[model samples]
Target: METIQVVFLTVLVFFVIVTIHEWGHYYFAKRAGILVREFAIGFGPKLFSIKRGETRFTLRLVPAGGFVRMAGEDPEIVDVSEGQTVALRVKDDKVTRIYLDRLDERSGVVRGEVTAIDLERDLFVSLDLDGEIERFRVHPQALMISKGKETQIAPIDRQFGSKSVGARAMAIFAGPMMNFILAFVLFAVCVQMAGVPKENPDKLFVGSITDKSPASGSDLKRGDTIFAVNGTPIGGNFKLMVDIINKSKDTAVKFDIIREGVKHSVNITPAFDKESQSYRVGISADPQTRPATFMETFTIAGKQMKVWTINIFEGFKKIITAQFKLSDIGGPVRTAQYTSQFAAEGIDKLTFWTAILSLYLGIFNLMPIPALDGSRLIFIGIEAVRGRPVNPNRESMVHFIGFALIMLLMVVVTFNDILLLVRGEQ
Candidate 1:
């Protein structure tokens, strides 16, 4: 039951983030007068689909990611010779009929019944010719008919390639931008709803002191307010005070405490704990928080976003510098577990993590790796500089390779996550 809930929460969050990201592309593409073929959530076989306003919106089986399929983004070269049959549509007719064995090698004009009519493909009609079905790929503006002789190509104006460089960049960048916007908004809402921490500056009151700990042997007591540490004013930052104490490994640190309206100084030495890998004073304090005003909430949210963004960059740096272990990386399984744990804690925690995940997703997608929006932007940048687009086939191959590598990485990380889970269970 718990696993089911975790899976459900994970899927829900994934769907929401991916849908918004794709919608960003769809919204900008349409605004830029580009034809969006499909706006799909998830990948692989479509589970459900609907056509509206020249775009097919679909839900697919896999929830890993989604995409906005713009026209001519990855155009396919249809091998007409491989097709055994041809579909033909009558001029000014909405319906198509397919005819079998209508191909004549000597003459061009062959009549056939159109078996399938796809309105989303811009009057794309399929027909069964010579006992095999084949689709005629033609631009929406210019319909073509071949008489068993030659093929004609019609250039479409509304394709992605036809769009200006600026427009193309906007469309590609919109996805990540939307993700950032999502994270920001979520953070703001969470702050407003949950309130911001309002630490008391007058004193840092100790909530508890561990038994048989260094703090227990010292003059520190519950309800005692710490005013300073090692002669440095602690201020209202509990983290700073804790850091000072933790860094005092085997060294006595002076603590200025105020208890019962009296001040006293005490020196306590912290012992290093190998298991936790930190010097322990073993005292905990409670942080006070108050509901934030509307403007304050926004300010807090903005600061939170900035801090988390920097943290992500730092984390990446650590990983690159080998300071962070690769096995520490978590995939979907670990993410789901965290989501579940957060959900169990409360809605506020879940919402906060959702914002964090959104920000991470946005930042990660902006990485200039192949198969990502950043990489696509790179190609677009090159095109802008050269005044011409890169060969679509080559660009497509690069994206394919990048996508394969990303999948491989996901597999490795997922395996690591599973191993960690198994170890935890044991």
Candidate 2:
């Protein structure tokens, strides 16, 4: 049951992040008038699908990452070779429907051998019928039925490549943008849920104690001010207090406190924390928190976001510069481990972890790596400089290679994560 809970929670956390991230792309793509073919969650076999508007939303078997499939985002498009037979439905001299494999025997459908076509520009199909060539106009919203699957033909105007560089960049960038939005919203929610923390200076007071920790069973109470530790005056210095306790090495330390104006002393032992390899009593200093005003909440969240972004970028820089080896990286296994660990603490702790993870995702996706949003932005940047788009095939090949390298790294990281788990290293 515990393992099942861990797995479920792990998938749920990833699912939430991926869903929000992909929805960002889908939202912007639709707004830009691009034909969104499918918005799918996960990979592999399809579990079910719900289509709305021009997009077919699908939930696949895997409970991992998802994608927003915009038309013309791919290097390959619909192509018809000469001397091939296909059925078409024409209305007002325009080809409204093209049947590739199904509905060929249906009435009012004209079947002919294809000689030439222009699906993107002129939207016309020329066919050789009984030794004479006849051309028919293709509708802007023509439906192409192939193997019983119907997909609306994407004209040049409705394709992703047709959009301006800014619009295309926004659609591509929206995935990471959404992740940042989610992080901010989660940060705001968590901040509001747990009162906003205000730093208190010139005072070392107890605010709370960790459950099952030494301080939780001690004589320390909330609002009690620490005056000294083991005969040394702390003088409202929290770090000094911590240093004294850590140096104690699981030995009982004397704590002098003033509780409600009454001076008292208590003996508390700092237990060893295997995770940090340090001694800890698990007591927190007074945060001096109060209910944040609506306007103040967002301000605090924004400031917190600044710190998260800095740390994320610094970590990426370290990894990119090879300060640490790639094999030292963690993967989904490590994430699952942390998820289970934090969830065991409480919902609030888990929520804080989720927000951090979301922020990391948002920032990581913006790195200039192939197969990432940042890489797409780089291509767009080049297009802006050159006054035209890059070759779609070349761009696709670069991304494909990048994706392969990423998968290779993932395998290595997963192996390392399991090894670390067994060896008990963080």
Against the reference, the lDDT scores of all candidates come to 0.76, 0.84
Q: Kindly give the stretch of ten consecutive residues in candidate 1 with the minimal lDDT sum.
A: 146-155
| Candidate 1 off by > 4 Å | 1-7, 77-85, 91-155, 199-286
lDDT of 2 by residue, 1-426 (tens): 276776677677888888999999999999999999999997769999988877899999755467788899894345567888888999988999988775546679988899998888889999888889999999988888776778888889889999999999999999999889989988888788777555554557885578789988988886788888999997667888889999997799998989988999989999999998999998887544568889888987898799988988888889879899755677888887788777665566677788888888888888889988889899999999999898999999999998779777777888899988889776
- lDDT of predicted model 1: 0.76
RMSD to native, candidate 1? 8.9
Local accuracy of candidate 1 as per-residue lDDT tens digits, 164-248: 8999999999998999999999999888776666755444677557767888888787667778899989767888887887888
Give the worst 10-residue stretch by lDDT in candidate 2.
194-203
Most lDDT-accurate candidate: 2
All-Cα superposition RMSD per candidate: 8.9, 4.9
Error of 2 at 199 (Å): 7.3
lDDT of 2 at 232: 92
